[model samples]
Target: MTTATLGRLDAIDPAARRAPRYGGFSWTFLSVELKRLFRNSSVVIFTLIFPVAMLIMVGLPNKNVPISDVPVAQGGMSAAVPIMISMAVYGAMVASTMTGVTVAAERTQGWSRQLRLTPLNPVVYILVKVLCGLVLGGIAVLITLILGSALGITAPVGNLVLAGLLAWLSSLMMTSLGLAVGYAFPAQNAMRYLGPILPILSFMGGLFFPLALMPDGVQIAAKFTPVWGIANLSQSAIIGTAPDVWAIPNLVVWFLLFTGFAVLMFRRDTKRV
Candidate 1:
């Protein structure tokens, strides 16, 4: 019952004796990925610099300018707060979505294929990416808020906190877009598309200018763009005013659409490998 049993047990197939691999989420992997992402100088520099620069340079001139014709639903914040909010949103969104560039590079290096050999589920992998992106985004948001405070951008404590939270949450939509591009294109080509496309989306979403100040057609079109809803929501939060009827629903729709699209593209890309 001792030596004989031990010999028989050792003779069993080593593969059969190994534990069954059930794919699931991994926080340890996510932590490593976050640390790796933070080490990228380009991402860290961009996230740290862009929003503060925009607030100081672009916002200072218009700090005291009241938005003359804002609707009742939109709050009564000065131009400065909206500018701070928009720039913060822009910085966070760009930083978060830029993770896709990393993802694209990983695909180029065959990392995605290697990921398939692990016990991590695909859904969990994407979620981890999104969470990492948000964490990076939060850094940008905090910096923007601090810079805004230094620049004398003021609001109620609750309003400031709410706007910062919304800005960070809205960045997830861009993260989805980035993941889609990474999976759908090579890294080099993905950056080519993303670099130009980001500012355009930012403009279209009314981050550069208030929708009320735009022409009616542009305002209508802005409602349908990916970033506008979150931007608007964040803006309203900063001003302590209600968002438009479409803001929350529009944000929800775009977030879901982009997220679903990313999942589908990732599955398709993985299947080919």
Candidate 2:
């Protein structure tokens, strides 16, 4: 209030007056976001329940249809095994993408603006959201694995675990894609556009069927879809083969592309607010 008081306040270190910096990942924020996500009924149904249901419907019939006459230990697996893993990947993609899509709602509700006023770092906020998406994705994978096991899809524990992990991690690309879409479009429009595209991408990526079974032209184009590399790479763990050489590059390129777009859109959205 007074000049003397102002002088004393100014004399104190400026850093001490500043709000605490949340420079890195915030576990507390992650927990809060995860709880908020789980509370949403639609999220629970689509991300957790839908994949398992699909597995039961499509996978049950194929459970005993072996792809090769050899044993699972010799890199021979049941037809249902890849199908189950594909569903896990698909579920993870849906969960992570939906998690990113929530940003649009937050923006519309002024939540993003409010966050700017807190000590929460913007990057940390984004990181927390992405991690929340990944957590949901992981849950989807776990549920699928459990159902797959109950349905008699068997493999070595190590291979199954590795396949599940890859399926979970592969959804990271979709998290960025979701953020980019959420920041670029309205909440309603984001899902409206992305909802149909995911399955199409999955089909093109060979999640719904084997690329070998498709026509040659479709097979060639399948290699270019965003989901192809990750899907193939995840299945390779169970198939007991080295992943195609191009799989890693496809994933890296798409992830970087989505992330760069997300950053740009995020900055533009911030400016508008």
Each model's number of backbone clashes? 0, 0
Against the true structure, candidate 1 reaches a TM-score of 0.87
Off by over 4 Å in 2: 1-24, 70-76, 118-121
lDDT of 2 at 172: 78
**Where is model 2 poorest over a 10-residue stretch in terms of lDDT?**
17-26
lDDT by residue for model 2 (190-249), tens: 999899999999999999989989999998898888999899898898767788899889
Candidates' C-alpha lDDT:
0.84, 0.84
* Model 1 poorest ten-residue lDDT run: 17-26
Q: Tell me the RMSD of model 1 versus the true structure.
A: 4.9
lDDT of 2: 0.84
- Show where candidate 1 strays beyond 4 Å: 1-23, 68-77
Writing each residue's lDDT as its tens digit, candidate 1 over 26-51 gives 66777899898988989899889888
Candidate 2 clash pair list: none
